[model samples]
Target: MRILQPHTRPADEAAARRIQDELRARAEPFGPGPERVRTIAGVDVAYAGAAGAADDQLAAAIVVLDAFTLEVVDSAVAVGRAEFPYVPGLFAFRELPTVLDALERLDTVPDLVLCDGHGVAHPRRFGLACHLGVLTGLPTAGVGKTRLVGEHAEPGAAPGDGADLVHEGEVVGRVLRTQRGVKPVYVSAGHRIGLDAACRHVLATAPRYRLPETTRQADALCRQALREAGTESGSPALS
Candidate 1:
């Protein structure tokens, strides 16, 4: 059964705002987030041709991580031809169908979902992570490789240093220098998690490299799956 309503036509600012508000209101507070968070799933999508639209193609994959030691617990993959067109504020329509289907193939429910997208840091105050989190009613975080919607200074040449991702006088997310000088990931709470907790989780899980363990593993899985599926593109290029 689908948790969110099917998308309707007339995608506009008003419509976007309405959907965002509805999801945000429905989002629940944090619970026992995997006590040890033993399982973390990282999701990534590969696009073929134009994004969205039935003509386009897409592939999604998730790599479950064993949080304690940051190792791959399990992996799942799914692929489908696209059925929607690329839209700025309404990515859910373009990607959610295949993504949800892919997630359904997972062996276990992840303690937390780390998406290679966005969360509340959006013009409508909601992004892909926020949409998926509420739709799945699970805790999710957005890890963008670039600034989506905010202003901040580059952190020091030291890992763990970060600046606030502020927009319109409100701090939407954080520009985290997960690795010194390489690049920063835009960290934001998707749902059922606070900002502080969200950042901390990303940092903690990223014990070895820049991106969190799950994300890196999942990213690799996406590429491998796409290659095995004989597709040209791997995933959405955020960098």
Candidate 2:
């Protein structure tokens, strides 16, 4: 898989915020993606230390699945130390370097990417998925287990039920219930995709579990990769 590099990694959180604002402006939050996604990849990261700590070792994984079957097609992993301190709204800075390394190791890029974090749902409207989508120029969306910032009522108990996640008078994402009676996951546009399409993609990828298959598979793979790299079982980190 080939990646188109964006600007160099920022030197600090302030720089990262500036970069995010700049790139967020360039990101097209509304556009059509692959109409028929043949393959979709899930990207995630696991950490061996405290969140955002520079000494925190990181393991990033990319798991590609056949969109039709939801079976693993290909996978890649990368391990390294965190480059930046964990900042509240700039989680991308801590994870993206290793994630990019993992993506580059893959045999082919997927038609779409599902990230384990927020997208426009973030404070700066530039979450990990947004950052990755812009950098890779791929169709991407985020499926986050928790809301980073927003206010919403619980969606209905049935599958596919959703509510708007509003912040600052803008609907940044949706609170989608993937499975009946299960906790909802937050869905948001990353880049080159609209919120409605993003929700549909998330539903398509999440068949049985509360989380999407892509996210579950990628999360497991990253944890395993971290252990294989001689680290103990580490806690999962927001993408």
Best candidate, lDDT: 2
lDDT of 1 by residue, 84-119 (tens): 566666666667767787787777887788888778
Model 1 stretches with alpha carbons more than 4 Å out: 1-17, 28-35, 50-54, 231-239
TM-scores of the candidates are 0.83, 0.93
Stretch of 10 with least lDDT, candidate 1: 1-10
Look at candidate 1 and tell me the lDDT of residue 121.
77
User: What TM-score would you give candidate 1 relative to the actual structure?
Assistant: 0.83
Cα lDDT of model 2 by residue, 128-147, tens digit? 88999999999889889998
Error of 1 at 157 (Å): 2.2
